[model samples]
Target: MRHPLAHALRWSAVGVLTAGLMCTGLTASAVAAPGSPPDPALSTPGLPPPAPASPPAPASTTADGLALTPPMGFNNWNSTHCRAEFNETMVEGIADLLVAKGLKDAGYRYVNLDDCWALPERDADGRLVPDPVRFPHGIKAVADYVHGKGLKLGIYTSAGTKTCDTAGFPGALGHESSDARQFADWGVDYLKYDNCNNQGQDARQRYTAMRDALRATGRPIVYSICEWGQNRPWEWAPALGQLWRTTGDIGDSWGSMLSILKKNLPLAAYAGPGHWNDPDMLEVGNGGMTDTEYRTHFSMWSMMAAPLLVGSDLRKGSQATFDILGNREVIAVDQDPLGRQGTVVSSSGGRWVVVKPMKDGSRVVALFNETGGAQRIATDASALGLPGTAGYTLRDLWQHRGYNTAGTVAATVPAHGTVLLRVTADRRWAAHPPAVEPGLDGDPLAVAGRTVPLTSTAADLGRTTARQVSVSLSGPEGWTVRAASPRTARALRTGRTLRTSWELSAPPGTPTGSYGLTLRVDYRAPSGVRADSTLPVTATVVVPPPPGESFLSDLPWVSAANGFGPAERDRSNGESAAGDGHPLTVGGTVYAKGLGVHAESELAYYTGGACDRVTADVGVDDEKGGHGTVAFEILADGRRAAGTGVLTNTMPAAPLSADVSGAHVVRLVVTDGGDGIDSDHADWADARLRCRSAS
Candidate 1:
């Protein structure tokens, strides 16, 4: 069977680019400059003439051929990102953590080092050498150390005359053969060859040069081609490298990850046991995205059969990161011997359904919620390419739960969350009761006027097929439920199932809160038994909080919470972040902590400051978090007024006032001090604004 990503949205259809690819905003650092001043990343001091290239070695026969499966391990690029921490010590720390954290037993074997590992110049023998300050023990020592711990080692280099980083590290331009031998001599098991300042060389020829070089070394190293998909490597990447990057570098943000995922979702055919599509590294513990978003990141990468190279400070990782990285069921999907990459099968209302076939003939189905709000995403077995309407037994991979599906399956996916399950055909026979799971594919969280999708997966277990099955959602007064179910029941095939939907809308008058919701599935089984009277499962309907007060206050305050950088309000550090969405709150207080563990919060929008002057008491939200120091500020137009220099722990509210005369908006900015943003939930307590005069 053709893989979905490879055969769909092929390069021929997208009009492959020459050398430049539109990266949108997420690819700020993905491109390489033309022959300009030697990028610091590309320059290396001169050295003695190099020795002759070595002869090609005989082919080897390793048990699991190189990259027969997506490589599981950690890389230093994203997590450290030129932080000066990409060193031997860092690699040693991670190598230790991988063993201590049981990652080794979980199949995470490689410990890769990215760029900036070399000295400013090559050795007298014309060979690359480790920076003495960062790797005093030498490259071979680190490789030996990693190997001593039962893990493989990977390294990075560029195909051009220079590297991509600002430091301009040396490249393999004229020394591919020698460099390959050098890596093999040092026990390098993998190589990430990048595209940077290649002197305008043809990518295919340049990559091929290195590929043949590595092959000649006789080392079973995994060759990773990082060309940012500019030349559409998928068209010819299988022979170039074990894996090839399909897009530019991935930033540690929701938007960046989503953009990369969307770009790679359609190219599954080019991936298999010995070759894969690389989408950069994992950002699970990078503190750039939320825990929920990280889950989506891991799920999508696994489903795509991409390398699971984590790029975080594993030594300092949190439990959430550990769970995501150590998820065995998810890992199994990525390491499936069949090596088939999953592809998007269906999409509706911003929800996507991805399915990958397993070695045992089972299918891994993922319901991804792409919108900022929660959603109901559902898919039928037929849509997943099932031969018949067999009722499938579904196993929630993350939650570790097992249940029988109603022939079709649905899940309520949270914003940036996924419902991943392993589905196997269920042919067991049953008689008597019909069943339905309500609200099966939507989040309990919703906004007024926005459709809160709900699903009912109905089942007919008896020998006789039900003539008709009715499914509907029980609505609140004045709330309308529109359901679409099958008028006539399908035949009672053993594994076949039925699914129906109900989209409910919260009335404009509905207040912000949670309400009860129930769904019913009534059907007559093939044995003439009625299940319409059975009780249905119930879920909650959460209406979102809108603007408190009209045209003046029509828009909810927009917020920018987290990214490793400073919040826009951080005048002291010249740091800024941005997001154009309503703030999230709990218990009537805006939980203004931004993304990641150390986040920033800037809540601002058009506000006449009610009467042209806004006053409020600001402090840390005592109810949500009790730790961390947060600086609070009030700004009107461009003028800064009252502010709380810094508040730590459960503290008293400090008065804040902003003059809004002739101003159109006021902003509340909170910055977590150098201590980081863990538990830095700031509150704009008792805020009040004066309206503009109608005079």
Candidate 2:
């Protein structure tokens, strides 16, 4: 699917290193309009906007309104499986516990079923029939059982052709409208739409298709888009979903838990009241995590405003799990009606501090030490800006206690633990204080050989999007112009020299190379305001080697792989040609990740000499639920020599196969399609298809 957004950056050229000032503007959308009043409707006490509008009804009951504070719920996938004591009996038992134990009274309403609920095939009429063997009473009966208990019931499905379980149920695409109707008929309230087999389509189409499908049901199921983090969903998924997955599946291990939390901190702004950045599900009540890690997990997730989807055996939950889940003070932060995701204010090694600006004009601060040792936490009076002659109210969220504090508060946080302090006004304030000007430091930007620095200032501006600044420049003789980081068409040309112009957008992955263009300041303020200022710029370009030398020849691997080294025969050319060098020739296996391929093909090497010894170790995880395949092939002396296989257990796992000559190649082909051979266990380790000179 072609994204509506084609331009990521643009650049122009001016003469030499330094260029004069030009007009620049920051549009209204780029910057928040000055002094806009806060929207009261946006901060609900706990409920957030529904995922997005779908048939039946949009996931949200309110229209773009802020969410009610926190959401509490239990999901089954974390502990339940197709095998091992999971049946209608288990479901009923868990459901009974949810009500009898006061979890529902504690604000957890949804009893969400994860995967493996469907039968191996749809009914003859194309309607998905529940696996009668698993749930003898059917899904509707289960829904009623939960609904009678005053709790909502949630179900799951995939956007692809098959469920992640590789079971033969239909998907949302082509079947979206139908499946949605089915879910609605089943009285489903929350739809956890997953991405299993839908690899060929772009995120926009895949997500939007299901969004529309769910809406078509007229059932008002919450739309949850599960695409991992490809295409930066947080930037656009809100249009299609209420919540979007932000990372790979999280396990119930301390390392897995911490890694996921740290990865999401930089994306704090993407989360808000109605829309949330989901970090998979909560694993706190699950057994793999320690009590300390579980507490930290709940604390961090709540601070992050992440949807609290508890993934554990609630019936068997320990007292610690209940305490962690039932902490109303901590839940207040997670359910903070303001919906503001906490942001990192300070960090050092294993200890860090974060602050969430509350709608009540106060701040919620968390001092976290995720290590095995205790750390002292101190809040500077200057940083908090507490006025003299007035005391502030400090509420300990975890301890559920309130007190008065003046200047600063000090506490020692235990290892792998947190101290959450909700600082609010002791008495109702007349009005919020003026916005403070944030501090910023400027640096010299080089263009060509000139420098421009010591000039920019950063201040507080309420805007959803960041601002971009550019410079225009002219060049000297013989320097026609090479390229720009932000490719732009507007260039200032004069005589034999060309002026260079620049524009900054979101950064890309390629190393930010220094372009040889004169630089100037084109200020685009967050508020549609435009200005021009003089700034310095410099240039850094890597000069190519002499005529006789080739870039690839510089690597020692070139000699090690032999002149008979690896090289590609053909490429699928199925997607964009962004950073990849076409006609890939590998003296060795140039293995890079994130290929974004939609079809099956090969990455092969060709050497004139008859060669073999082709081996590969395949690591596969079923994130979307359906099976993924990887194949190894060996080509020697212009003929196929050997091949091997790796497949999924649920589906037939296909082995690696190839047919080429010694002079042809050795390769790896990964795809969504195959002959369906070894589909049961989709994993292979160092599986090699070796064909050497059979001298």
Candidate 3:
């Protein structure tokens, strides 16, 4: 996603960074403009636009022979969005986690840094350099650190003049060769080239320039072109890079993942060995989708051979996520020697049958149910182009069980879920393995700092006495679950149900939000091996920040009060002020540091503490339009705490303090004064609250 803000920081030959002298709280859509070719997806009915004339094709990226299988690893873009998380420490932490958890053993390599790497301007020699503050030891040192752990380092750059200046990162516009040489010099193993600040330059020409530059460096960097798939990279990208994005940035939800899948579904033929299609990074462990949905997502992506650069905070991943992402069997299908992408052979009544042919004479079929509820779907062997054989065996990859292959392969698939079955010939029918269905009695929701009861049950679905029936609760960091009886009856006999329960709570600093709770049941059949289930449950914890002055940027929810426009968040301290052209000043004071955004913003807090002091610094935004007169106030339970009597840009922050010992609600408001409301980038700087513990 090339933020519109980047285009403002174009650099002059002398390496000076300058943006336009303007400030209006006006924002632009990240979406493409009308009449611009919609980021290439199957066109909506009757809205097909004219296709472009075929351009001359460049030599295939196969000449370089990289990303033979879609690259697997982690990228920082989604997890941190170039904020504090996009740093050397974070990258190192990810590498450490990957190694600690055996993800490296499962083929997850390449810890890629997405955007926000370099300082805002080029060096005196017009060469790009790392932001000394973020990468203090330099890019080479970071690469060496990663290489020491048997992992590769991937970096980001823009194909345009300026990278996303939104993060103060410089670009490789005219310094393609310099940047490429610098990257090779740093031992970079991969590059994610973005399409920001290109100034309407031709995408192909610019990307080709970087490709040639990288080749000239005589290094093997897996090139990933991230132009938001605007030009249908699948049709023309094979010659430019190992893989190309086939759509805009992906959202971390069923709708978003499915949408990206649908778009890339039509382009599967274009994905093969050496050159593959990318549908953006994986959001598997993120909070948007359920474990079932992630399973479907991972299955689909692997079937399509899409790169699996995970986007979640790996250090916070649960066992379920690690299992889904580190499944060597599914990954093997994706990284099959023949490198053939899967194709949806049939779809009807909301059920889909996708088949991928492996290098060995076997086929991986996925029965997908996209309906509102569970559905029993069947598959046609002929549809998969499988050789007619009577002794084919069905291997349930996820369940680690086997069943007889049927011409009409059938399974009762859960809603929005998938049943991935790998079918192989030259085998006899075997009895299906014993299975266990694990689930929680009720999905619970509670406030932070409060305990909730967790009750789970395991039902034996086969005639197998499962032993060692125990249910363990797992969640992301900051949460813990303690069970009264985490273990079930010594053994769960066939045709019986075993139940276990737990008490779970979030610690003091756990932000109020929804989190995932996984119930991992470890059970074994009489033979000591059959099947086990990992069911995911959800919990919503609501806890306000501690009684102290919490910044708007750190709060859970801050919005426009009384139907005001949405509040703009600028975690990059001076970003908002600079956008408006002023020395980042707010509330009568100057802050050299954190999130400073224009106001028309309101923050709500639970002010039930015993202490009484509350204060807020207020002043006009520093940018050009940020100069308009604005009003700032601190209110408790709809009453005023402090206020700045209409301040202008020239004024420093006016301090407003109030006492609300018995108040239950605290609100901070930044609104424009009566004038035309221009330059009303009000800053509610340094809002603070003093509290006493209630014993």
Candidate 4:
């Protein structure tokens, strides 16, 4: 994983702190307001250009036959990085749980150790030494313990003079051969070689040195290049390592995951057997996001054929965590023998359809929803490169169900969720019941005590007709749901639809959060065979903006990210600790209410389409004493509504205003002013939003 010092040094050298921040965590994909217009670059026709006929097999440069499929394993960095708990006991416990919890059986094998496993300095013999307190029995004993459990062991080191952590542990920069021999002697099976304090060495030469050294050991250690995509490792690293990181470290948030997905999705051509495009490790079970988001994270990783490195503390994992991790069906996609990475079939309006051609001639279709609300994402078998067969069999990998589609494949995917389906041509598909895909149409954002009208539709995509079709929508406890129209139909012919309307009302005192709603569909065939399906729906309760002007700091933000520390309210960006900032000040003036943030920061608030205008005075905080430069921009639903040219700490505050009428979410963004992020403390003084009364 990347460290702050590495990021600061890398960006300061390039004088593009903003770009570095974008890769680290504050990516454009993460800050783009939800429900925004689709990126024009990703907008394609319903049927995208077909994938190459007979895609070439990945050329293996190492010739070791290692990592034939993306490595499935556990990495300790994300869960307990450099913590006292990340010791021999924890590593052994993870190995035990991997087997006891069925993860090893489900395809996870490696139990890896990240940084901090070693002492800060090497021994008198110039060999790296394991921390005595951390691994009292030594690395070999832990490696043996892991191997005894039928799993592999991975260790981390940097290609620089020191590892990424502040501990400055000795790295393998000039010691590649010695370290490689040492690791091989210990029975280490995998090596994560990172980029940090490299002294500006050539990435290729440095990595190749290790690759040659590892090969010299006559060991089959899987090499993972963690250069953070600084040198486009995908273009050359395949010949040197089994996998290369394609992005910066991944945070446990929807924005971070989505941003990395956008970065990695374009490099599908460079990934295959024995070599992979690593998009960092998995953040599942980390708890920064909901279970739905985690499912999407896992589903996308599997779809992309990316390395599946579990980055959670499995000892404290819950049932939901195990359920997501132990999904053998999803893991199969990642381990698909074909070794083809999934590519986008079509994308528009925050909905994406990605298809991966399997060796069995089937296609894995992932209908992904990146919007702020549930959406009906769809694609047809033809679009997925399937022949014009009479029928197609669809297996919902997540739901573990079988379905038959005449041609169209679709599902109502929740916000930040994915519906993974494996579709294959099946001539006997007609023998199965009709594949009725269910969808919900309505605003997912609801006001407390308001009756929101919603419609659910079931479309038959199977070859045969369905009889006695019925649909029901149920809300969470304390909420009322009533059918507004007929919920049953006598028949639903192929390609026809049955629609049911319902009025949903949440109690006045309902809290603000996502609530679950279930849409169940029951249908029978002409021969009296019956089938039922239940689809989950999500409704978010939001508080409308107050009438009249109100300071932005008073409202709870939907999400926030900062370059150096957490965004502060009505204060100056001091240090990393919360509430440690001074009063908001810029150009020697103090403000009573404002936001203090570092460069490359973003704060979003749910406007609920009620706010019409936002006004603020933006500047680099005077606390830096003319040391920082930055720019500010405001976005309404991902569209830039207002912005300020570069501003330095020496300049007075600049008034900024934006027309945010009809915007559901308004975002405030700050970026480094070209030079770097040194002392880049920014402020939004007296920021206020004006809204109409909630009707």
Candidate 5:
């Protein structure tokens, strides 16, 4: 099956939409409608309009008042490590710089210390204490200093038996209430709750335990969950915490950042005001990234509405670092009260653009160039579904400046760099109100149901021109309707109807699952000019499972690796840390300890080097022995090493005597030729890698 992201948008059909010479703001009349198929999202209503968002709580007063927009402040784990004790002087020094550098005034009022704060052992009362040698003033004194600087203090703890620091500080399992009370007593404003060793309990139970515990302290503490996506927290975390780390630990590398962001685009629905999808912490202002990469990091994070937990050593940053961290335009989006997180609209050839709708009716757009070479990116106003004659104002967010843009505005973004733009209408111009086509209601159909091919047939919404049309549906379950097309069109409402034109080719896959379909229209026309219009288009899509296989069992991995045979086997015993089946000669036995350990196996010509460093071609056959067995040989340059035994496809009746071949390595290969297969799964519990190595 094709990936959804790859077919979400069309590249060839892409074009620009700009205002006409005669068109001004409100005076614009012509609507150069892009041809697209009808959208189904408009007619449908999303989950009963989410409940009114709560107000922001006082950062220092409540244990759980109201959640805030963007989480503020700095985290120390990324840039430095605390040894025997957290250096109180270092913390105080950074606090001083934070105030002096104006970070506190910019809504960044929290200074979080991550781990390494406790002494080797707790006191008799099980109370965690700061190491006196490093913190002569004590933990309370440190918190007080941060508070004096007008900043809140955040601390970290594990839910496991031991902290990540390996310190003896008490964890928050059975003693959650106690830990919460202790943190409140220490004046800790934020608690970074880690999910390290507490794997037995579900995230909800573990998290809720802490949440209720903290609330019991009558302390308003922000709960940050770090489970590494093991439990898909987006489905339940918002109700318990202010911010949730949506990805794994962040490394200051372009690859790591890109992987994290791309993986997170689909989870946008779970993020909003008071609830955030954290992409770990900010790596901007850190030396690991170049100026361009740093800019990309900050822009992407802002667009994603991620928390602004600057991880750089603020006191030592250069001018470039300061500029990257102190970018107001980028920060505004992150701090927007609307709390909307941007999702990817289109991406291709490593050149992608993400558009985020802001509360102010403006848009935050980030154009990223992940290619190896610089390239230019330009978008027409029409592509944004604006009136035929529309005018736009472009604000280069990085430059902190705006420019009047018509037709197309282009920029040359460097490789691995980004262009951040805040696109809005010029205040001088009046915005055209969107026209609501009546009866619009349709959604992407599920893959299993029937499918109605979109064609030139009017009944099937075949052949089309550009006009925003809604795909409506009437079904018992409010069936879903999807487009198998190339370009990403605007989904209107309820993830059903969308803003589109007749020309939109069906998205690349087949549309299925809808019991019925119709098209509604949405455009900006004067209410009196014309009432809502309906373009009724209907058809049925029939999709069935593949021959002989149920949908679930037909998945890629299961189909490719399923049972055991002389030629193949399913080594995945569903066991933890146990190696798969052992590949041995048809009549040979593999001598080994620890019967089951999950590890990989393969068969390839052995390179004459240390076994650890040797590379294998994976699934290859051995045609040697002409049918003979070689003696077990282990030699380091023909000298003796350790193990005493012969290693070969031919097994001996008894264990061989000890012989040190001075071998720091072992090599096994087919003296004759055999078919070469790469990555053919194998097992190794009772056998050895004959023609191929098994695990």
Candidate 6:
């Protein structure tokens, strides 16, 4: 979890800024750098360095001949942990789907069970027992069923006295030999050993004990160390396990995914064949992000050569989920025989160029956009370490299209999306059409009955010039689009772009949501080869809050992402469902109007520069019985305006107010307080924004 300090506070004291008023000056303490030292209370003792600036000596492989590439499998923890739906039938159904849905053919091979698979206590023989209700057929029977489909079975256990689930099933601490033998007897093929209730034991020694025990059983069970990167497993786990988790549990949101990726990016040198870095699991079908964001997640994971464990429920997966998880081209990058992980070529302003060398001398280039809006990301072949060539073959892996490039690889990527391409040197590339990528400029937000100007750019990035280039923009039905400039050109020279401006008008009754606008480009090559490309643009229609003071909950949000479940209105975040929470309560006080959300949550509203200030009573919700910690922040147009120091349930609700003058977008963010997000139910009580009528 990210626990950066808040931005400069304009008001000297809380509650000083009244409704419809603005504060002008900043407090010295509040204006300090946001990168203060980590809170002592939240620091883990005896932990290794989080991320080393320079790479260490190359790690020796385990030589176990397992996980030669990153493991591709399904884990049941993310979608249904310890729930009734995670029963024997569900496991069998997943195995059946792995074969039926073509996932097995795509290289997914393991069927793993997470925590809560065992009974709370060991039997009279001092051996762990399977939960009768969850796995009625027993462990061996389930293993046999999975093996019948040519898949492997993986089981979970903690290195401490109890597993991570609330039920605290028996762990394999002092029973390593007995437990390893038991797992081998049951035909287990993988072990996910976690770190919890560790009894202050040394991480390396404990994990090594399990390693030797598993090897003694003469079974090739792939070892996965799940220590959450507290002890820098990448420095030592390569010779002990096939993979080691480099971060805490992954949440199904763009922020969570991006945070973990940033953590894993620096440790690329520690990854190779038979041992790899695990950035937790895939959240493709978990429904916390859009399809475009999911594609980014998959593309980055594949680029980094991380494990491809399916974390969504297979029995209820959508076609989009299958499409992302079963992308064979991306999967090939992950399972490439070269066993090399991608390294960052350049990163700036949330635009990243990551290149991974393939076994065949080809390079997998990913143009990733992490900003909140569309932007052009580009890189040349020389930057990718490829030798000079007259022409290069550029394959858009996601679009499955090929083009002849003079060396430039670029795309106009959407917010939180990626454009994956494979580049290889080819001299006979003139036979294909030039790569003309489409992009949009200017703001994407439009008000009902208002005209918003937008520019569409078509860039020719290939060996041959694009001839007779034509560009057009189209929106939803009943919406109007009129070009303000010429929409066609005689030719688009290589490395050049043609721009066209348009006036877009939405109907007066247009709904306040995201609408798809298409940018289509058509061109021809000198060889008479014609090509056309269509890019999807998202335009958000927003209705700003009305004048005067209004409860924040009463206004429609432009976007909302929660760490756990959905953000509730006038209630406390209870679990993973809407309308499942109780009345909003913080420090024993109940509020009728507020937002209840878990830490690592974000809610954005289009203020349209109409708001002057926002005030709220913020604190951790008392529903968790004084057990959670969180921090609150207010950002006006991506610049922090106010923040609350770490707040816990034990404290009373803190008053907060922030200046929002001339801000187009106001965001309310809640983050876990240094520690992981466990029971971090946060609330913005009596939240109100004072705004003027939109011009």
Tell me the TM-score of each prediction against the true structure.
0.63, 0.53, 0.60, 0.84, 0.54, 0.84
lDDT, candidate 3, 1-695, per-residue tens: 11223223333232222222111000131112211343422521111222333434556676667888789999976656656557899899999988999989988999998777788778899888788888999999999999999999999887766665454356677889999999999999999887766667677888889999999999999998887666767777888899887665665545446656766766666777788878888989876577888999899898888888998889889999999998988888888878887877766655888888999888899888654334556665667787776535667778776644434455656657888888776545434433455656533545567777777667654444668777677887877787777466678765577777778887766665557677777776566664456755556554434655555445554222211122434421222223322344653346543234433334555554444877656676555333455576667665676766768778766777878677655666555454223334565556566776632
- For model 4, the stretches where C-alpha displacement exceeds 4 angstroms are 1-59, 556-611, 614-687
Model 2: per-residue Cα lDDT over 1-695, one tens digit each = 00101111111121001000000111111111112221222211112222222212234423634234445677776566345455666777777887777777777777777667788678888888787887889999998988898888888777666655423355565777788888899998888876655545665787787778777877767776766554566767767777877654564445445545765665676676667778778887766555766888888898888888788887789989888887867777787778878877666545677777777767788878754334555564346544443545566677664544443544556546777877765452112221111111211122223222222222211111123444344333433333243422222111111223233221223232333333333433334444333222222222212222122222111101100012211221112222222322122222232122221222333322333344433323232134333343344432446554433323332334334334432333332223211111112222333344322
Clashing residue pair totals per candidate (backbone < 3 A):
35, 95, 14, 0, 97, 0
Can you write out model 4's per-residue Cα lDDT over 1-695, one digit (the tens) per residue? Answer: 12232233222221212223222222122221111222222212122344344435435653678999999999987777667889999999999999999999998999889888999889999999999999999999999999999999999998878776656688899999999999999999999988766777788888999999999999999999987766777777888999998766776656556656766776788788898989989989977678988999999999999999999899989899999999999999999988888998877766899999999999999999876556788889889999998788888898897867888999888767899999989676766777898888854667789987888898888878888999998888889899999999999999998888888889998888768888999999767798877789877787888889999999977667665546899988654456767899887888999999876567878787878999999998876754666789888986889999889878999999999999987889876565344466889999999998866
RMSD to the true structure for each prediction, in A, is 15.6, 22.6, 13.5, 6.8, 23.2, 9.0
Better of 3 and 5 by lDDT: 3
Candidate 5 lDDT, 1-695, residue by residue in tens: 00111111111111111111100000111111211211222111111122124423323212345456778788876666444323787788778887887777777878888776777677888777777887788878999999999888888877655454433355577778888898999898888877654535666788889888988998777878765454666667777888776654555545345545654555676787777777788877655456777888888888888888888778778888877777777888888888777766566545676778877777777878754334555554455434443446666787564444443434545556788877666543222222222322221222333343332111111011213333432333444444444222232221132332222222335444223344434322222222123333322232322222121111111001111111232232211112323432223333231111111111111211212221111211121121212222222332322222222223332222223122222222111011111111222223221111211
What is the per-residue lDDT of model 1 for residues 532-563, given as tens digits with 9 covering 90 to 100? 52222323333222233222122345333332
Error of 2 at 653 (Å): 33
Residue 653, model 6: Cα distance from true site in angstroms: 8.4
By lDDT, is 1 or 5 better? 1
Model 1, runs deviating above 4 Å: 1-64, 426-695
**Model 6 RMSD in angstroms:** 9.0
Would you list the clashing residue pairs of candidate 6? none
What residue pairs clash in candidate 4, if any at all? none
- Candidate 2 Cα errors over 4 Å, as ranges: 1-70, 166-169, 381-389, 427-695
Candidate 3: worst 10 consecutive residues by lDDT?
21-30
